[model samples]
Target: MSTEQPQSGDPTGMAGPVTDDARLFPPLQGRAVPVAQDRWERLVSAVDIPQPPEAVWAALTDPGRVAHWFGVCRGNWARADCEVMLDFEDGEFFWCRIQQNSAPTADHPGRLRYLWRWVGIGPVTSVTWTVAASEGGTSVTVVEEAVNPPSDWRSWNGMGWPGILDQLAAHLRTGTTWRWPWRRMGPYLQVPLPAPPFQAWEALTAPGAVRHWLQPCAGSLAVDDEMTVVMGDASGCALLKVTRLVDSGQEFPSYLPYLEFELRRPRWPAPLAGRIWIEPVGLHESLLQVFQSGWEGVGIPAAVVERRILTGYWTSAAARAQMLLRPPGAQAPPIGPHGWSLSGGDDG
Candidate 1:
């Protein structure tokens, strides 16, 4: 899903650091909390592992070890400004630039800082990882910070860290890694629209137009409106509640409108929270940024099943929306022969 051109050298990037002995650490619980101060909001999560600092540091910097817990990381982090790519298998891939990578010193713990961006959509944020010695082992902490984040920013980014850190602990302890069940820890997707902002926004929010692409809705898309969504199969009712609404010119004229909503279905353990921002690329073009996260409390297998069903639903909806927005006889850019699925979907 990364649109950037390939780098010039080292197509595979550098191999991960290796050590002769891979130590096993006993697992312990981790914690995550959202911090808001001044203009910035940050997610902080930490976990303690019963392993030495050197072993934990190796697991943190080594791509091979990282993949066991996090994702497939491709980059040379020996210096600053290195282009880093982390692909979280299901179509969730991210490209960032490392701002700093500092090894542990006698006086301080090891730290890494990177500017996280997803190929031109959504706000850029900073992610920092720290490794320090704990009472009996090592403590690893991850912090992600952004200025003026979305309404559900904390849940979108914070919900998955405890699980992620648990996986990390499992990796260091068992030498085997299980797939992380949750998928909505960050921005879900961003796609270009062939129409202007007005057209795209109308197609996304207007009840009549929305029915052509998304499911049928019983009420308007106004703030605090609790609408009942008619599912394709009509098995049960789906509920949608609008939480926040911001038009482009009302606050930030140059920016597109932002909408936040909470969706609930009969079978879901928790409501799915979503945020949409329609950015005007030009007078006749726009970009849609979508963020979603929630309802993964049901372990790995059940979560995977839910994700598969939702993937198909969202893919078909997006394709229909694109068709509705396209100008007559004008071909939009080729998405794919199989249809445009979300980057994290199996079809994608």
Candidate 2:
């Protein structure tokens, strides 16, 4: 196969243009191209192990030993909250959190599940690793679910997993993660927000206020006290329901919607749950920031939806903020790169 890089419109903030050559190849010959509408993708990688399941399980469960083959891991094995940092030969790094673990059983000797987040990004991806004892050796499999990753990420990750798994297998047999050549990509787009202590709490709680800002699609909000919003197309629409709301009381309002939204799309999961806060930086200016934990699932990635939602919300929020603070006769500035503009020429 050709090693020449491909070109695509910039997306993941990676340097240079992205190309189709960077994507993962089809698993089967003559298989149809996977459509984005499916909302989830699964990549499975397996390797044969010359060691026994106990030895393989030890390497898999011991964070310190696993780091020797995988990447740097920091956390207590006794606790489930360990964080792992995977440094690729390319200088790129991935941060992952351990979410699930099951002790080895007779049928399946060892299994582990983890959630990964690109160090600086907003969403979380997930991976599951399984090991089983077989005739004269152990069999290991790694399964990953990428939610809303930039298109190029899929291929990059697909290529990388095999090598990592191979290292794991080799380490189990010979005890070392072999080195490989890799390069770090470019930076990503960063969108900043203002501090909050926003207008009145009523702005978000009132029906009229909520309607003014919430984008309309083919969904509705329904629940007892908390509200649920459902919107999307034929493939699927996400359902976000507010389960709890409290400001500065330890929990944040954003968590309610974030959790509900994620639950609705179990196949494609988000990595983390975060608090929402509104702080005031200027006399009448406020910032609404949402800090979320990452999650992973098996469909159209969440990164794609996150970018679109961020762009839309920022544009709309700016417009609304201006309308609230500007004088009656003054008009708000264009909100986004593509908004309409008015010339200085006066009307006849």
How does each model score on TM-score? 0.50, 0.41
Q: Write the per-residue lDDT of candidate 2 for residues 21-121, one digit (tens) a residue.
A: 44555446686653333135567888888888778888878767766886555444413577656543222245567777776677656778887654323
CA lDDT of each prediction against the hidden true structure? 0.66, 0.48
Candidate 1 deviant stretches above 4 angstroms: 1-39, 77-79, 118-120, 182-187, 190-348
Clash number for candidate 1: 2
TM-score for candidate 2, residues paired by index: 0.41
Residue 318 miss distance in model 1 (angstroms): 9.9
Candidate with best TM-score: 1
Model 1 C-alpha lDDT per residue in residues 1-348, reported as the tens digit of each score: 977554466465332222222233334756555342224677889999998878888877788887778877767642588876675655455566788888876679999888865432335778888988889998899998876554456886655378778887888888876557555543366555777776688677777766555565576678887777654342445677789998756665455688898877767767788876776553466666666676454234455544544544554555556666767888654555333232321232
